[model samples]
Target: MTGSPAPVPDRATRIVVVGAGFAGFETVRRLLRHQRRSTDRPIRVTLISPDDFMLYTPLLPDVAGGLLDARFVAIPLAESLPGAELIAGRVDSVDFDGRTLQVRNREGAAETVEWERLVLTPGSVTRLFDIPGLAEHARGLKTATEALYLRDQMLEQIELAARETDPAVARARRTFVVVGASYAGTELTAQLRALADEAARHRGTVPDDVRFVLLDMADRVMPEVGEKLGDRVLEVLRGRGIDVRLGTTIDRLTAEAAELSDGTTIATRTVTWAAGVTASPLIQELGLPTEKGRLIVGADLSVPGDPDVFAAGDAAAVPDLAQRSGKGADDAITPPTAQHAVRQGKVVARNVIASIGVGTRKDYKHNDLGLVVDLGPRFAVANPVGVHLSGYPAKLVTRAYHLLALPRGANRMAVSAAYLGDAVFPRPLVSFGLVSADEASFPRSQGIPAPDSD
Candidate 1:
């Protein structure tokens, strides 16, 4: 007879959340809070991400423009998410039938972890196109590192342009092209224009030589805020000497120039591609039904057939109950925005807890709280709760919204301090020299493989 049978494994329920963006971070935080209040069952919360900090991505343009410190936007997960196991890794694949995940840690080791419940919030990445030389030369503004690199790159280009004996070379270096005129692209263009102006002054060069070109295929700038406010934003940008081009985009980009769709080519050394974002590549690897590259989930933010699997944020196509019209339910899906992601995180957390027999599940439904666009100093556009405001009032509302939206107390304080310092002192123009060109490339920083890669 055998001496003993195999020992039974721990029966505690395990919940694994992937990605630490707004949705995943909020989901983990809310779940941990619930675990502390309830003592009926044992629950293990695990968060798997490549980085240990959750990035407040809305402030990335500010960081890129040197208005805020990069460190202030990154919230340490270990400190913020207490009572949860933090695994530093990226999920490579998911075996939905087996209820397990294949993850590769920072050290390049692969590991398999089983989960009782799974939450997918691996947020979106820069939406790349098949345009030639795009992945090779274009830079993204998604992560903190990318933002810092952009700041340094802008400064470096300005410095180089100031000293070069060749006028053509200087002009090319001073010219900046920004694609996509939505929130990220618009904010980035405004902030960068200010930085370039200040840097040009410090370098003893003509600020007018430093040109910014903003391009978007849409007919208006920031149409999300409606026509009235959008028109105001366009006027502000034009007043700042930014060449805002509507109904136009880059057809091709090279190290020296960008060819526009309108059959015009401009000399430029830096091209910032803030075009758009699509769901993470991992979402498509599962062979699940997707809508516009995002995993399709029901109104309750749960997969149709898989009850234990939940999804939210940019990775999931969630139904917008608030906007449901007489047309059809499929016609109104939530737009992928940080506001929606944060709210969806809270709803997903409650539904997950309900699945574990703690409470009843509820559907996710929220109306628009309005939009805010910060266009450099003393200039902004906002429609708070359907009230349009521009200029100084809008600026105040925009800043207040950001400060209040930031989760951590320390981060908010640090950001506020940075803003105060910016008012009193000149913006810093020195490059840190920490991130290299290779290190900041799209393939290296954002983890998006090249087009030719298998």
Candidate 2:
């Protein structure tokens, strides 16, 4: 007599991606595209993230300054990735050895997912240092909610100032302080100043009276962009009456003002901390090798000693092939910028497909394409393909580039219409009164109230 063995259930190869930023979104999209054309076997693709939309971070400043609507920049993930399973939750912990993940939804319900391949693109969060009172007072520019909160805060301050007759209180309401002169800080500073200037025209105070201070620890503003472009940006900002403080840091932050390391204190009601970003704590929990908080990955974007795991974007410390001496030289690392993240996402997708025997894996190698800083209409600085362009022409190039880079056609059209409308008509100077103290602070996720609940 022969005994029958148990029948094994059929299962599709499951691919799970975490964090729906530029990197994770791209990876899922590419894999689904590949799976769509394949006729051999079934492949399952799932994206797990806290938010249901993929934010277009480049245009966030515009939304904060009321140049573009918030809806224009946030693309619905479900619609964007039609065929993939979208898990609306934050990953609590990952079991790499078991190929499983523990995720918790907004309602505190938890679930576990098992996958054949895993991609980690949990983007970095606002970098908080040991500075006193910073986490309590300053706001970040990472998400659409933060940007909208900032916009409402700015407008509310202006409106409150309009009702006050006291010179000191009015001045405090009109003043705005932003730290970090890099891409986010610099761009936000410029846009906010423009917003204040326009709104001031409709109020009692003149544009020149509105105070804006842009501070940075680096000697020159936007040094990463290029020396020439930095100088031009500095000039434009200065010409707009923005107090650009180079080689400075915030000594202390208060509800009413910011104390600079240079012993100068600026009285202001608004403080924005775009200083920098650090990798999310989720990466550290994995106990993987990391450089400056970013998980280390190889040339193929695969995590060391874990062939099935891969990482990219701000969460991964990818070696810069262009900056390195040769194959083994791992001294230089690629910057955690949107440009690199987008390309890394593509490479990781290709390699992930190759891992499942669909194609061949390729190493990630890309040169810096250049940088563009939009300082509102008729004012921008760009070094596209190593050619310097500034002022109006630069603005046009910058807008065109954004339109091309935006993920959705609807978003691109909305942004374009907003740009045109901005040129023709003035933006409304009003606040929605939606932002609260908890929603407008650094390190907000831990105990702060959710935006919708509040």
Candidate 3:
């Protein structure tokens, strides 16, 4: 299973992990391996999270575009992590001094659990602003539910547009707008544009010239990548007829259209918001030192002055030791990328073990390998170890990296089959209305009422 069937530890040494994203998952995984090899003590590990699956977020755009099935990206926690105990619940708050966590589940039940060692990897939530009607009108792409819902919405809009006799109504329904030029927004825009291209061919009445717009407040698309690659990506999107607007954003969003800051408006029914993400709200409730909503931890990934507590991933502002300044500087917080999170997770596990006197701990340090952006099946931009590549070779490297990085199992096979099958057959357009977003959208503030003015 996930861990060795050793004797259970007493309540005092119980290890409780607080998330199931890349950081927490890797922490538990490394703990299991070390526990199996050690005879020092019974390492009782427990994981508490809202969902039982660790979503492989990189392939979410492909899933939304019908290039891959939803099941392929959802790695089952119970099956993959048998060594650790799983508790499906949402953490409300943490009492650092008391070493207790208040958690609530889907059934509206709340409970408190005490632990000896606490690992906080609560991850992050979508970053939203105070724009009017933006929350109600725009959809997020952080979770699987959002991805699936967007797919259905896209299909339903196209279907409804094809039947509309009014030309103006049809055009409005065919138009789609996406805000955010980060990897998530850019990939979503690129993949969905590919889907829309093929979708138009099936319906004769719907104009083949369906409009797709990409907007961002940044100066260029995917500023995370090099300017050369960003320019190339911008050129590619423009060549494919995607209206790429930079240094612009939505001033006001209505159900019918989005008003841009430049006194322009676009009529559309679909709006996907992928602008940014912030640390999970649960982190702030802990009363720990924080930098911009992220828990501040030492190079060892342990909370300052709290030897029993550790934090990592997007939830923690871990210092980047590989930065220009050798000392941990205020401006050298590690970037919230999957690569850093994965490596940080492993380091947290080792440090936690060392906290229990099992082994020695090392400082969290690593240089970035590179970045890869999947523009589409044949187009990609990548900088692997300072070497930049684009087009077919970049696409190949991008796909290979994902395949190698994804956890091995039936899910990997399913993902591979879906990619191969897309070339042999028409991509599936069926939209089974199975996923919903009524309660899952913004997790931390859900069901909580605003405070009354004194």
lDDT of each: 0.88, 0.85, 0.83
Of candidates 3 and 1, the better by TM-score? 1
Across 1-454, the per-residue lDDT of candidate 1 in tens digits comes to 0012112225657888999999999999899887677667657788888898999998999999999988899999888888887888889999988889999976789989889999999999999998888889889999888888889988988888878999998889989899999999999999998888888778777778889999999999898899998998999899888999999988898889999999999999899999899999889888899999999999999999998899999999998888895344656888889999999999999999889988899999988788888888779898988999999999899999999999999999999998888888878886896887677788778778767896
| Residue-by-residue lDDT tens digits, candidate 3, 1-454 | 1334346646426889998989999999998887778766557788998887888888889878878887899989888887787887888888877888888887879989888899999888777788987877777887888888778788888888878998888888989999998889999888888788678766653434688899999999998788999999999999988899999999999888999987899998889888988898787788778998899999999988998899999999998888746645647989888888899999999999999888798999898888888887579999998788999999888988988888756887887788788778877777887765453344323322212211
Candidate 3: list runs displaced more than 4 Å.
1-12, 204-208, 326-330, 437-440, 443-454
User: Residue 119 error for model 1, in Å?
Assistant: 0.3
Global CA lDDT of candidate 2, please?
0.85
Which candidate model has the greater lDDT, 1 or 3?
Answer: 1
After TM-score superposition, what is the CA distance of residue 440 in candidate 2 from its true location, in Å? 3.0
- In model 2, how many backbone clashes occur? 0
What digit string (tens of lDDT, one per residue) describes model 2 on residues 187-232?
8988888788888777757887778899999999988778888998
Candidates, ranked, lDDT = 1, 2, 3
lDDT of 1 at 385: 89
Clashing pairs in 2: none
Q: What is the lDDT of residue 313 in candidate 2?
A: 95
Clashing pairs in 1: none
Q: Which is better, 1 or 2, measured by lDDT?
A: 1
Off by over 4 Å in 2: 1-10, 325-330, 445-454
- Top model by TM-score, which number? 1
Global Cα RMSD, each model:
4.4, 5.6, 2.8
